[model samples]
Target: MRNMLPAAITAIMSLSVLAACGTAGNESGKPADSGNSSTAPAASSAAGAGGNASIKGKVTFLTNRTDMVDKEYKEYAKRFKEKYPNAEIEFEAVRDYDKTLKVRISSGDFPDIVLVPTIPNADLPKYFAPLDDLGLNDKIYFKDYKATGGKTYGIASGASTVGIVYNKKAFQAAGITAIPKTLDELYAAMDKLKAKGIVPLASNFKDKWPLQSWVYDLPPAIAGTANVANDRIKSDAPYTLDGAYAKSFGILKNLHQKGYLEPDINSTNWEQSKKDVASGKFAMYLLGNWVINQVIENGAKSEDIGFFPMPYDNSGKINSPLNPDWFYAVNKNSKNAETAKAFVKWMIEDSGFDKFAGFIPVLKDKQPELAQLTEFKSFNPTFIEGVPDNDQAIATQNKAQIDPPAMVQDFVLGDGKAVFDKFNKQWADAKKSLGY
Candidate 1:
């Protein structure tokens, strides 16, 4: 249940711009002296730009892989190092990452490559560099999506499938014989687990957004079904979050009222909750590939975990949505923009695509091992074909609305009867307002 939840805001975004901004060291020793301060990057002597005369400059990256204390993103960083042996690549793991990214953009000291954060549209434009002007157009895989998202802004570092992750051992122990195919079954299964004294759902509510993903992640699949007009789910359409979200909420609320979600779900620490399930105390969680990695690595036998495709719209039918894991971007201001582009090219095209780094690469060849946790293949979609090609329209119609605005989160976090009453009235009003 909680494993299906998205991690943190900063953790997920910066990995896409992994080569970009990182922790900034106040190494000038001139710190704590003035208000107008700046972080001077450690210099490198490596050659860059068409094999220039000893290119020695630092490319700061923003990441939290600092836990890999001894091992850096050694592979990709190593290649960049060889190309510019004299350059000292200073990898910075910024604390309070969301704020740090904003500070850099304001200080005129932005990272060479910065992540285009999904921050509800507040700070995206200034930090993101458009790939179109760089001639990266021809090389990108989604030529169908070429002109779509306005700016080629940046490419996702990798992609993942979003769904519910369950403990196979827990399910077996609880004597629950099948994965829940629809909302009702999911509730009934949770009830069965509760009777056994097992917490049916576990997640880090403190991290906040993990809970948020429940609200946001699922709308795209159900809403995408009508494939609505102008690529938009009509304001009057029955399946839009306005229509469907409350219904989803009602389902989740039914679970909560029955005590399926853990008491104090908000109190759980993210790492520990995930570990708890991997350790087999909690039975279910919602998550994507990242959680799968944790379950497998944490001593859980390979066959012991189940990743469920969430049941949406009461239909019990499977409709998986694409989860964009991460994307890459070039610094518009860099003097060696072409070489930077070349570096991005090397990542997705050659060894970069299939290499087992911390991420699941999106390129065509060698993808990280996409393991199936259950017999339900539809829970994990393999392609983006036959889907509405509009990017924001797709997000608006399907995903963004899923959690709170959509049905998923409301059922988990809000007043169920209230959400239903409110949205249902809103939908009815919209029909009249549309004058149809």
Candidate 2:
């Protein structure tokens, strides 16, 4: 079992612009102008006067981070009890959380606080209570991640930048003096590592999602936009031979064809990948900073590991794509909606939980001191926002059977051309169904 949950940004030059409250972005990174203004009653911030009186009941906080159950949450629970002595909070942590959260929502038994459900933001009114008036909108780092219909639906728990996590010792052994600034250098460095009898990159293709992550990793560098997916949606043939989408996949194919990825990628495991990368058995893994602690926890010295943005093409400066991790939202159906909001507010504004978890705080002035993110601090790379799927597009995608992750797996295992051709057809059909 992969003990570490794969945590899943915007382009802002200044941290203030990054923290500004605004309209939410659709699944394609386009502004959600659905024209549906939120008429739902605004839930007052629990920090306001007389708010504590309504916050005494038990509030169930749900998250996918089972690893934090004994480590972080226990400490948080203790601190929360000190503040709200009468109120009780319980955590519901589980594996395969995205699927399970949907199951719970479908059953109408969802918890009070939801952590990054796979559901669309437009549909948030159905499941999560609004948090627009909580005074947290301007304080958050990624406004678009949870904004919908001009209302903030969820509060970002923390922030992270996607980059190439690697072993410094392995780089040294491979005679790599400086970090690669281009894809050519990266591939060359991988070749050197392979020659030194080290696994160049831990593909973790067997895990499916890791392989599927190329969609996230390659685009910011290739398209030079956070709204890459949305751009693809607008272009009739975004996956054409000369397009950035095709270029991104071509890089993946090159990596595999050159044997820079693990020899038997289909059998590779993520849990073991952490240990191997940490131990210098493997050189690198393209992942988010959220997995840095997991790599350290799996038995390697923190100093041994480092992170750098993916150097796709010959771009002089690496464009690091920043993103918010799990977002905490209050469930609309919760009996203790106010209390749940209070708990979430405490966690976001007061608890200082993000700092302890090695996360970049969502607040504007806050900066992540995480060792892996140290390299990016001075780089001043552009922060790219991720495109989110809208309800209609999501419904169309479901009907079209366009599974990018599964398609990625098929590309590697079977025929690449055939797989992408099917994908292009499905995506077109889905778009047509939505009258796009």
Candidate 3:
């Protein structure tokens, strides 16, 4: 992951203008605007072939952003239609995206363009079309995440980093003068906040999914390597007392055991937690920077919210995982593949959707201008890009029936070391059975 950052940085420094427009050629040796002209004539060929073909067809897009379907998405479709008068873009938004999409995929009723779900990387070719012809392989971050056999499948929509989204007003009210730089300092600040009757951290533990921040997201930072998941594949005893999993889970255990979390852990509400955290009832959330805008939208003043890397340990040096969010891909069976590919390109390059969604842009040449990201960078922390999990890694996890978030919930309720030991046994047995 570190190896990829320097090249991306060089690309960013060399760009005088954003790659959204102009004649700059990407790593594929094709111009950024090659097939993106609004007035170009429509072509019957797919857009992946050098991206010179103008797209015109009816294409269906499946998105998890149900909140934006009516307003923002409508505008996107309208603007896309204006660019290609003969084309039509339809969005099918689902509230339970992963579950619904999985069923749809099994029934062969999926849309043209869809967000890639939690599926094995090796199965990418079976469901999604190769996007190599789009000419974005080297131009975009996480280009290799869904690629196989030299053909790329999914293109990441955007990226985000894990951090502490805190309320500045709450911090001031608690008399905390500085941002916590170490685990001990963080605990001290949380104590101060707790004394002031603030829920020091909103552990949305009941939601199950948000708990992934500790197990899935923060482990990479704690291990100081993007290859944490891959590394686990090589060892049967991945969950040890001294390993990253134990340390990451240990922090959550400490938070819960010390009464620093919400009053009602099991009955916590995700939506209301946002409102509570925004209003300063909850002082902080160890979450991604993506939540900052949502918190502000929930009623917090924009200036009242601040972001910083989670000081998981007393290292005095911070490392955060710069991970990609959902990936956008074209359905392999789509009849309107060209239009789908064209829409994906437009969404990634011209739509400005990443900014609207408060995400770091996926294009290496385009740097995020978000205020929270600026504040996060102010600490001079190292940004570790995430590595994609291989097939064996995913298989081992599934075989062991290891759900990190569920394990965390159990850890909070029971013994942390015992939970880790149980999972370690299961993982070792699974690995031996699979002959890994």
Candidate 4:
């Protein structure tokens, strides 16, 4: 689930104010030589407010989206250099980036500006530099997503909401009159779809990560609160049959029990399921708004694909989980601190990353033109506020070490009560090992 999984960091933050630092250049505009000398930014005294700060040094940017690297980010760099021409940006891709980043963090070998991962709110200060000092709070949206004690350490390029991606034509074919707004209504719609010989939901259990939608994505809508996940982490038996965790999982269990899921769920994969929904073989799938374009690109008619908030409660007021894919964080130990900070400021304030990245713009009055996101907003979904989970608490499951998705997959295979029981014990053990 990209929603909660720790992610790679993003760009921009300038160097500290220097009195008389000189502009330095390397052969071929590469990173300057680190001669164990002063690592402060080379800001010229001639530069003042609104004037270009002479920053020269290599800032390494690590990202998981190599596609964006050659396309969108290449443009971002060109615009960035318009101000600090001396700065050189070196790009690197760490495969399985989120997991590899953890290894790099443990080894003290992380890059200068990482695409900041879901490193949990409690651990933000340990790995990132606070951006509030740069006055980012008043400038950026969702500043509180990664803040603690009034210090903002991470800022997102954009935001996304977890919702159900469905085929609009399929609902019309099933003679369904309205979109579901509650768990009971969703089940009722499923019954209508099933009656007309259509799969009500697509569960890509073989890949497993998609199953995390039920665990982490759906519950916030059900509880009408974003704190459900963090709250469960602090609860005694998070997987009990009657708990909120179960209530959310209960939605999946009900789908399986009622024969509303796609056939042979355990063997299904995400790619084929995308086509299935496109072809009207499946009606809906639980995922973030990001998947809407992908589904359309996979040959689903763009107009036929619509997104709605996940309705897990009868409150008639559903809350879509708002998630920032990754935040741009400056590495505190970097030699080019001022330049890095400058880069961050440029990215947050000047770069048109939202349009290029196709995300919900986090800037004030800056709205996205993506129809899926616009459709989601039409529902007037409620937003939730909660603390970010520390790596120690969130890592075990997100890594698929304990594999909550696999457990849900087992529930699909059979014997859900046993699986929930086992999960409760394991979850408690994992949390206890972290002394919480």
Could you give candidate 2's per-residue lDDT for residues 301-371 as a string of tens digits?
Answer: 77787778788787676666665677888888888787788788777766655544556667655544465
**Candidate 3 clash pair list:** 48-133
C-alpha local distance difference test of each model? 0.49, 0.68, 0.77, 0.66
TM-score of model 3 relative to the true fold? 0.85
Q: Worst 10-residue stretch by lDDT in candidate 3?
A: 21-30
RMSD (Å) of each candidate, 1 decimal: 11.2, 8.3, 5.8, 10.4
* TM-score of model 2 (CA atoms): 0.82
Residue pairs with colliding backbones in model 2 are 9-385, 10-384, 10-385, 27-387, 27-388, 27-389
Alpha-carbon shift of residue 319 in model 4 (angstroms): 3.9
User: Which portions of model 4 show Cα errors greater than 4 Å?
Assistant: 1-53, 66-71, 77-84, 88-97, 118-122, 148-150, 191-200, 256-282, 296-302, 313-317, 356-358, 380-382, 387-407, 430-435
Residue-level lDDT tens digits of model 1 in 22-91: 2211111121221111212112221133343335456555553443324435555675566556543445
Give the winner by TM-score: 1 or 2. 2
Candidate 3 per-residue C-alpha lDDT over 1-436 given as tens digits, one digit per residue, 9 for 90 to 100: 1112334643442343223222211112112332233433223255533334357779999997765677677878987787667679999987656657867886878999999876677888889998877767767778887778888898888777889999999999999999999999999999999999999999999877788788767888898887887788788788778888778888988998899999879999887998999899999999887777678767887778888989998989998877788889999999888888878877887776666656767876575645776677678677776767667777677678777788888877887788888988988888888788
Per-residue error for 388 in candidate 4, Å, reads 4.2
Please give the TM-score that candidate 4 achieves against the real structure. Answer: 0.73
Scored against the true structure, residue 114 in model 3 reaches a CA lDDT of 97
- Model 2 scores worst on lDDT over the 10 consecutive residues at 1-10
| Candidate 4: tens digits of C-alpha lDDT, residues 267-341 | 887768878888888999888665665566557766788888888878788876766667778787888866677
Q: How far in Å is the alpha carbon of 262 misplaced in model 2?
A: 3.1
